[model samples]
Every structure is written in C-alpha cells, then in structure tokens.
Target: MRFAKQKRHRKTIKRFCACFGFREPFKVLCDGTFVHHLVANHLADTTVSNTLGAPVQLFTTRCVIEELKSLGSSHAKSFRASCRDYKLARCDHEEKESALNCIIKIIGDNNPDHFFVATQDIDLREKCRKIPGVPVLYGLRNALFLEKLSKFQDEYLKAAEDERSRMTDSEFKLLHKRLKNTHGLKDLSTAKNGSDDEDLLLQSPVNRPLRKMDTKDTVQFKRKKAKGPNPLSCKKKKSTSNSGPNVRKTDETGNDAKRSRSRKRKRTHTAKTSNDGATN
Candidate 1:
C-alpha cells in the first residue's frame, strides 16, 4: 500500500487554514520534503490553495536549499527544480545552529501574521506543532494531512486566536505607533498652511484669551456665598461658651474661700479673748 499520495486539490490544507484569519498573506515556510511534495501538488494543479485571506506564499531558506543540493538524490534534484521559482527567505543562520533552529527563530521573530510549516519530516512536524500558532502539514495514508492534533490543540488555537485579535485591533496599533514615536521615530503630520493653524487658535470672537482678573484688574463680585450653618464656627463658639462658664465658676470659688478665711480669723480672736479673761 502506498503510504502517501499528493492530490491536485487543496482540500487537505483547508482545515488548517480556516483556523486562522489573516489580512496579509499567510507565509508558508518549506524544507526539502515540502518542495518534493509541492512538485506532486503542482502536477495535480493544486499549487495554490483556496485561502480566506491573502493566498499562501511559499518561502525557503538558503540552508534548506543547500541541504537539498547536498542530498545528491534524484528526488533532491527534482525538488530543487520545483523550488527554483520561489525566493529564499533572508533568514539568520549561524554555523553553530542547525537549519531547524534557524527556521524556528524566523517563525518566532515574525509576528502579527503567523506562518505555517510544510514538511514530511517527523521531527520538524512535532517541533512546530508543539509551538503555539504554527500549523504543520505532512503526508500520510496516500494524502496530505495536517498535524495530528491532541487535547492541547484547542488550547493552543484559542491562545493564537486571542493573540491575533489583540494584535489586529486598533488599540494595539495606536499604542505601538505611540511607543515608536516616543522612542526612535518622530511624529509626522502633513504640511498645513500657517493661516489654517491661526484660524483654530482663537475659539471665541475675541482676538486674545479672556484676560485674567486680579483685585487690581476688575471689581470683585461680592455675592454672599450661599451660607450654610458653618459647623466649624459653631463648634468654636460652643467651645468658647463652655470655657467661659468654667472660668466664672473658678472666680466665684476664690471669693468664697476669702470669706471663709475672714470668718475663721474672727473665731480665732474670740478664743484668744476668752483665754486672757480666764488667766486674769
């Protein structure tokens, strides 16, 4: 039994493409096997798929091309011929890192619009499917199929959709533009006539703004501010009246003490007179 078959129609990729809605073209990155499959798809006249947004644009990296060339296989030569028309994506490739790493980096750095990966390599498919927002296309059972989704697929899709909605909305764009202007870029406005700006300067009929008025500038309006019972003033008056009563009570107590002392002095004189008489 043939393990896989490439169909002419785009029925396979439709399911994956439907999940994402893009205003810009959906970029589809390809490796060697992807190109090999594309040849089959091309023969079937299904090179272009029915897309909801901008159609998919196939891109490859220089390393991918180099890898295919080094394969020295008949299929590799055929894959190269099919991919000759497609442009090599300007991707960052370090000698230390593998081609897969470079591809992942590009996928990460490119944002707003998510890119899809097409490959028959099990490793690539598994790696990309694990990442959020990346859809993987592969061949199985004689036909192309999207990556086998697991339970986490729904969660990833939901997250991707939320991110997509956030990024596409006006608020994020305004904030991003503001940040750009604040940091590196300058705010740009179209040229306007000087007279036009002047026309908007004065909102009222007066040529100048209403002049500020101080005491010397104009007669102050003396309208009695609607007087409610001032609680603070009432409290102050109540406190003062309470203190007055206490002060009067203190003065009366002092006078009483003086009278008592006089009476005591009179009693002491009477006692001394009685004692003197007894002695005589």
Candidate 2:
C-alpha cells in the first residue's frame, strides 16, 4: 500500500513538472493586483496554480503586498492563505535598490544572453531599451493584445450563433446591415476587394498637393547665417582721432594744456603747504 502511494505521488509530481515545460522553474514577479485578483476569484487561483504547478515561486515587493492588503480584509486573508502553499518572497528596500541598479548597469552591457526585464511603466521600458542586452517586455501591450483577442473571439462566436439562428426576413436584413456597417469590417472589405479607385483618389494630385522639393542651394538660402566673420573679409580702417571726423572739437590742445597747467599749480601749492607745515 505504501509503495503504491509513493508511486502515485511521484507520478503526480512528474505530471506537475511536465506542465511547466520542464524548464527552469518560473518565479512569478507579480504586483499586488495579481494576488488580489487570484484571491477574489477561486477559479482564477485554481487556473494560476494549475498553470504554474509546483516549484513555481511568487516574488513580490513589499509595496505590492501592502497594496493587496489594502484591497480589503477578505482579500488580504485569502491572499495570505494562498501564499502559504508557494515559495513566497518579498522584495525589501535593498532588493528593490539592487534591482534598479541592475537595470541601470545592464543597459549598454551588451550581453546577448542577459535576462530581459519586464515592466508596465513606459519610463522604465524606455530606460531598459537604453541598455544593449536588456529587452523590456511591456505588460500593457500583452494585456491589450489579449483583450483585443478576447473581444474578437466573442464577436466571432456571436456572429456564428446569429447566422445559425432562424430569423424573420426583416431581422436577417437588419443583421446583414449591422455587419456591413461594422466599424473596421467595411474598410477591411473595401481594401480586400482591390478597389484602388479610393486609394487613387486619396493619392491624386488634386487631393494631395505636390510638394516642390527644394534643391541644396535653395535649402542653403533658407538656413540661418553662420555666426563667424565671413571668409571673404573686409579690413576696417583705424580712426586716428579720439572723436569721429564728423564731430566738432572745441580748443582741442589749448584746453588740454590749460587743465594740465592748473593741475600742476594745484599740486605745487599743496606740496609747498605740506613742506611749510613739516618745517613748523
């Protein structure tokens, strides 16, 4: 009985391991929202647990855990309970700082085999792309794509069902009209029909003005003048006079001599007074 139970347990573990591609175990670095979502919906938790299987670790930052806790008591309780079954790791200040530093260092590191960074933040994505080997996986892009696929699937299924349903002639006409007037479908169909007339109209000279391309010389004419002195230089003649030749001068040398004589007399008187005072 013990041997049979052991064999069954081994088989279960093997199956669980196989489900995750039998590669290096995935460490899910998720935000608090993911935890709350899993806990709020039992089916979601089951799906995630099944997909990840055993050996998958849950890594979250303290900030994320706090966010999950803030969701409500029930969500916090449920999340806490779910976390007990897995390898749960919390990112401390040091760890977060380390992660940020790693991101900064890896940018331009050019290691081809380096692990890619995953982030939803546009700023972070931009920062990561600056590094050579670090590729950023934008979560919003994947989310948007998944949402579009889901919407498409729903629309397709509804259309299929509508086609199958037995309807009155009026209802069928309305359905056909709705499908014909669908937002992108009409444009897509128009494109698929190879009708180049609309395209030609769009491209026609009447619709789109023919922009005259400027020659290199014409472009140079429009450019701002260079800051430096022109290579074809002109010499500026030096003016010998204090004032320009156009200006009238009053008593040019006489006023200068009178001022100099006055200054010399004033200096001689001051010196005589000082000498007399010194003698006294």
Candidate 3:
C-alpha cells in the first residue's frame, strides 16, 4: 500500500511539473511532521498541485534532525521520500539553545528576505515574529481544517441516510440509546465532574499551622546572636579611603603643590638656559 502511495505521488509531481511552470525555489522551514503530511496528501491526489508549485527548501536544527531520525525506519523513509531535491540546512549546532532559536538564526543569516516557515508551534510563531521578513504558517491548522471538512461530508451523508430511511420514533430512540451507550456520555460526564471537583480541592490550601522545630532539643543548634556590625563594613571602609576625603586631600594639596613648584622650577631653568645660550 505504501509503495503504491509513493508511486502515485511521483506521478502527481510529474504531472504538476508538466502543468505549471516550475516554481522559483523558496526557502521553506519544515519539521518532520509537516513533511510527513505533505507526502501523504500528495500521494492521495488531494493536495492542490497549484499550491505545491513553490519549491520547498527544508531548514531544521541538528536536534530536530535527530528527532526525525528517532521515529524509526518507515517514518524516516517517508520523511526523506516527501522531500525530493529539498536541500537540508542546519544552523550552528552549539550556539542554539532550542530548535526554534536555531531556525531563527538560520533564517536571519541565510535569507533575511521574507520566506515561509511551516509549523504549528506557538513558540516558533513568537520567535519568527522577531525576524524582519519571515512568515510562519500553522501547518496543523491546515491539516485539521481538511479533516473537519471531511467529517462534515460524512455528517452530510449520515443526514441523507436518516432522511431516506425515515426512521420511526421507536427506531430513533433505539439508535440514540445505542449511540449514548457507545459514547459513554453519562459515565464520562460524571467522571469529568468528579475530576474537576478533585482539581478544585487540590487548588484550595489547608489552613494548618506550621509545626515549630525545638532548636533547644537539637544537638546541631547554636543560638543566633544579635546581628552586630555590618559584614560589609570592611568594603565600605576601603571604598571610603580610596574615594572620599583621602582622595580629595591628595588632589587639593599634595599633588597640586608639587605640580606648581615643578612648573616654576622648569620656567627658571629655561630662562637661565636661554640667557647662557645668548651670551655664548
């Protein structure tokens, strides 16, 4: 079955290429799950070839690559099969704190221009917002919307069945009873309420007083004396000596006087030297 699916996907790709002009390659950030679904949809012939025109370029971190590999042989094969000619790009393996950060750095460094990131992760969305030109799409939402549309079609079929049968009141009641039994509505509702009550009870704190430990009875105990001089007093004293009155005293008197006297001596020596040179 899987082989057949793969063959069909290849045919679709060929047809798509024949129909639409080859799309300009766009850097696309995709994780394993996104690629898996893309493969499945393409094989099913439900995926719009028009939408698939953009050449997808996959970007991931080393961590995500390892995660994808850990999904076992079949999944790894499907993931690779889905991504034909898609260049795998990875960010700095050590600099990244998370997969999303790695993805962001890759996009920032490689394509500062706008590109598409296909992900359902909220954290990824938040991180991508900081990048100047990257756009992110929630891949899960697209898959889920398609699933819901399929379910709606099934419901439409069921309604049509009900109308055609024109089921009697007793027959309808029997069907409703079977549905309720199969769904376990009454038991599930009761269990759900019980769980909610348990959660509420856990959230409410008990008003019990904390038990005091008898320090006098313990051998390891030492009575704490009153806190005396600040432990930081030595630092304070050193800072004051370096910065306060002592620094000002050196600047105001000692250094200034020495500099003035040195200047006077230099001027006197220069005058004598010039006089001696003129006489010579």
Q: Best TM-score goes to which candidate?
A: 1
State the lDDT of candidate 1 residue by residue for 1-280, as single tens digits: 2223223223334545576443346677777777766565553214434322236677778777777776687566545564665666777555634557667777773233466777778787777766655767655433555454444666777766555443333544555466555545443233233344334332332332333345786777878888789687777443445443224343554554221222344344443564565752
Top-lDDT structure, candidate number: 1
**lDDT for position 152 in model 3:** 34
| Between candidates 2 and 3, the lDDT winner | 3
Give the TM-score comparing model 2 with the true structure, all chains together.
0.26
TM-score of each: 0.44, 0.26, 0.33
Question: Candidate 3 on 110-153: residue-level lDDT in tens?
Answer: 24533456555677766655543444444442342101112333
Clashes of 3: 0
Deviation in Å, model 2, residue 270 alpha carbon: 99
**Ranking according to lDDT, highest score first:** 1, 3, 2
Candidate 1: misplaced stretches above 4 Å? 1-21, 40-45, 48-54, 109-113, 148-150, 157-280
Predicted structure 2: clash tally: 3
Please say which candidate is ahead in TM-score: 1 or 2: 1
Instruction: List model 2 lDDT by residue over 1-280, tens digit each.
Output: 5455445544533532342123334344444444444544443433433433334444444444555556687676645854564333433245434334433443335423233343344555555554433323323211210011123334544554454443445544554466456434555346554354344333432343223344853545456866987655856766776555445445855553222222344344443464565652
| Pairs with backbone N, CA or C atoms under 3 Å apart (clashes), candidate 2 | 107-131, 108-131, 108-132
Off by over 4 Å in 3: 1-23, 40-49, 52-62, 82-85, 94-98, 109-113, 140-280
Q: Mind sharing the TM-score for model 1?
A: 0.44
